[model samples]
Target: MNLTIQFYTMLSMIGMGAWVGAALDTYHRFLQRPRRKRWIVFLHDIFFWTVQALIVFYVLLRVNEAELRFYVFIALLCGFAAYQSLLKKLYTACLEAIIQFCVRTYQFFAMLIRNLLIKPIIYLAQALLALFLFLLHMLKIIFLGIYKVLFKLLWMLWKLLFIPLGFLGHLLWKLVPQRAKIFIARYAGFLKQITKVKGIILKWWNAIRTRLGGPRE
Candidate 1:
């Protein structure tokens, strides 16, 4: 279990790295002025080049085979180049997957909240109104218990419906046409928008918590 947790943590870290990598690509591509390119190049040389040198040094210290180390270094450099060239595309695909996951999860949670909170509120209001009407001699409380049972039954039915609907949403995405895939390829922008929204929410929540004692005991 500990190993499994560590593995998952590593994956999460890699996902974060990929996210940062994508953001970096986006920033450099669109935001960098032509005159600032020299500064950016200098920064990249000072940072990533140093990292590359360290990787080489580490490989040389650990490897017994010189040819193997050379090959590894070549592969590493090639991978870095590929990563730079394809970072936008890779990030876009990752974001698309994330968006799909978020949408489905949101739908599931919305259904749950509607059933648990909203439905109960509506039912309570209706029950109160019915009770008032009955007291006025226009109705009876004979079916109050039956209405209670129906509320419970309706919630259960909705839970079942949304669960299957969420699954179907996932399934439908898998059946998209190849032509539409080209249009969907701009998913990194979608991810960026979502991340911006998340950042705003985080900031708002943090400020509220800092001001108030937050959740009551």
Candidate 2:
């Protein structure tokens, strides 16, 4: 409307145009269009253009009440042209350098954490596990050795007593009445028969349960 407003609007549009160019470069740099699906690229393009348009319109609203005169377009084009000719190469180079720095920083921190924290913890855990296994193995061997020694001593003691005890029992049995021996032998046979009958019944029950697909105790 007035000279001051018009001048301000032109300057704002020029700055907006340069900003848009820079934003476009950044977007495309990250978008990786060749790797993106068609639908995704399409959506991203629509959103990007919409946002840029809205930004330009909002700037215009602030500068000159959203007025659209012919000079605004000329000024925007000039600013974009100036960025392309003068600033594109410098900005791109700086951006690449910054990206490399960031990647190096991330890699350094990751390596530091792995070496300082993770590796030591893993080694300590492995050491504890190894020590535990070693102690368990030693305990097993010690118990087994003690068991073997006890078994041998008990076997020797039993052998040392058995012959004399057996001879004494034979002499005592000879002194016993024949009728009493006969009664004990018959009762022992009866008990053996009962045990055999129990075993057979249990076998039959287990077989029946198996055939019926029932769980066994």
Candidate 3:
């Protein structure tokens, strides 16, 4: 190659070497190999080296038409050595600062979204639920009040009819013959005895069912 082409290739190789060093540092910083499983670290290392090789080859192709020479390798090594000695610390610090800033920004946005959107939606749902429950409570009270008022009115009407019927019954009793009155009394007594017997039988049945571990109803 001409001297001009050689110089350009040398410069490109040096720059590429420095870039590779920086990329390696960045990869290690993010990868945190010590925290990863051995197999996982192995896989990541393989991938990183493969990608770096491909990038280096691509840059070499761009600068020197894919030429391979001893001086190119020497220039690359010098550049990498220089970066390790002079730039590693500064680059690592800047990388860490940038990563921290990104993390903080994400956290801030998440907090803002939660406060502005999610919290209001949650509060609105709670308020709607409370309003629904309150309306249901009010409806129950209103219905109960109506039921009580209707029941009281019916009770009063029944009382008014009952009083007149009781007076009519007494007059009818006075007009009834003595034999018919005796018959009615005997029938009522028989009915009362039948009811007592029925109640006694039901009690016995319930007791038997309870002993058998069955429901009485």
Return the top candidate by TM-score.
3
Where model 1 places Cα greater than 4 Å from the true spot, the runs are: 1-20, 25-81, 137-217
Q: What is the per-residue lDDT of model 3 for residues 8-102, given as tens digits with 9 covering 90 to 100?
A: 98998888888989999999988998799999999999999999899989988988888999998998898898889999899989999999999
Considering every candidate listed, which one attains the maximal lDDT?
3
C-alpha local distance difference test of each model: 0.62, 0.88, 0.89
Model 2 residue 77 CA deviation in Å: 1.5
Give per-residue CA lDDT, model 1, range 59-123, as digits (tens).
43444322332344445445455556767676667766886898999999999999999999999
Against the correct fold, how does model 2 do in TM-score? Answer: 0.77
State TM-scores per candidate: 0.29, 0.77, 0.79
TM-score of 1: 0.29
Please give the distance, in angstroms, between residue 4's alpha carbon in candidate 1 and its true position after superposition.
32
